[model samples]
Target: MPKGKKKTESRGAGLEEYLEGTVFLDLWRDKMFLGQEFLTWLYLTSEKNNHFFELPGGDGVEAFFENRLTLSHGRGNNRRSVAITTTEEPRDPDWDEAYTAIGNNKRVIKGTLRVKAENREWRLTLPHDTLSPQGVKLSAVKDPAETDDLGKAGKFLDKIALTAELVSIVDELFSLFLSRRLSETWLTEDVPRLKEYLSSRT
Candidate 1:
């Protein structure tokens, strides 16, 4: 058999076993579950979140909401607080493959977010006499304007979509690597060719 055909057959068998109940299959499943759990945890932990826009020239703009929740009785009350921040980054030369070292020279809109929740106590008890119920609050901390020409752009980045795109990219890159299509100059040469092939499918 030809060497390439043998290698292909070997890889096919490995992949088949990976899709079966093999140890490698379990490892892959576990990793995927871990990643899903992490993302879900992040969403649940944050009380409030914001999205910002990145301008072309220098700075950016953002808009966010502050949430404050209060639990009150006749005389006693409790307060809880949280915050969310959203920001955008324009597609620029700086964020290209040469700088970010991710993959292609695609411009990414990045969002920076933070959330905090605290419980506050009341002095006197009112009609209801139960253990202190927590109050939830959320706020947006930073909103900086730009000195450059580019104004703020409003575009939401869905985490699920981004994750899917990432997975696709990884799958493609791995297939290329396994096929020995990637070399030291792969980034400079083969990457574009692979992209063209991918584009043709669309």
Candidate 2:
């Protein structure tokens, strides 16, 4: 949130690759899988696929994956590919072709994500590598004049709050995904179904 700041200091490794010699690594591994799997399914379910991720109370969010996709070699690595297509590749002719990228031993790391909730729409790029969102275009403020905090600080505060809310929506979406993704039904039922659907996409 610090805009136009320069980092003039260096620090140690913020995190270990595997969190070796600890019990947290188990959590880390599951988290890594959850993130990647969620991203993958989100892309697969986008744009009139009838895969609306249900919100907590009611209704659902319409998810759309943008044309630009970043694929990586597995989970942790510097290697990544950014494919910029002209059309809505996930929902159009190139949809089936997009899966071919993942089949080639690469995983979808992140992409331009479009999520619509109520009358507001959020567009941002979410990185699975660190769970950090970038280039966020958050929803419009419902009422900016009613703020107790004033001026730039107020605006920033509102932005941060809205951003956290948006991220919470994403977290809810991930939970919805995990319900099916972590189930034994996923392997026995959903996997075959998804494969059949993908095979039919062309």
Highest-lDDT candidate:
2
TM-score of 1: 0.18
Clashing pairs in 2: none
Candidate 2 versus the native: TM-score?
A: 0.71
| lDDT, each prediction | 0.27, 0.66
Tens-digit lDDT track for model 1 on 82-168? 222223333221212211211222211111222221221111111111111113122222243422332444312322333333233
TM-score of each: 0.18, 0.71
Off by over 4 Å in 1: 1-157, 181-202
Q: Please give the distance, in angstroms, between residue 101's alpha carbon in candidate 2 and its true position after superposition.
A: 1.6
Query: At residue 3, what lDDT does model 2 achieve?
Result: 21
Q: How much is the lDDT of residue 57 in candidate 2?
A: 45
Which prediction has the highest TM-score against the true structure? 2
> Candidate 1 — number of clashing residue pairs?
15
In candidate 2, what are the lDDT values of residues 1-202, reduced to their tens digit? Answer: 1122135442235455445566786776766755666777777655326646666545577777666777666434766565645464454634555677656555667888877766667789987755567899987647655654467987798788667767767766766777888788999987787666655663
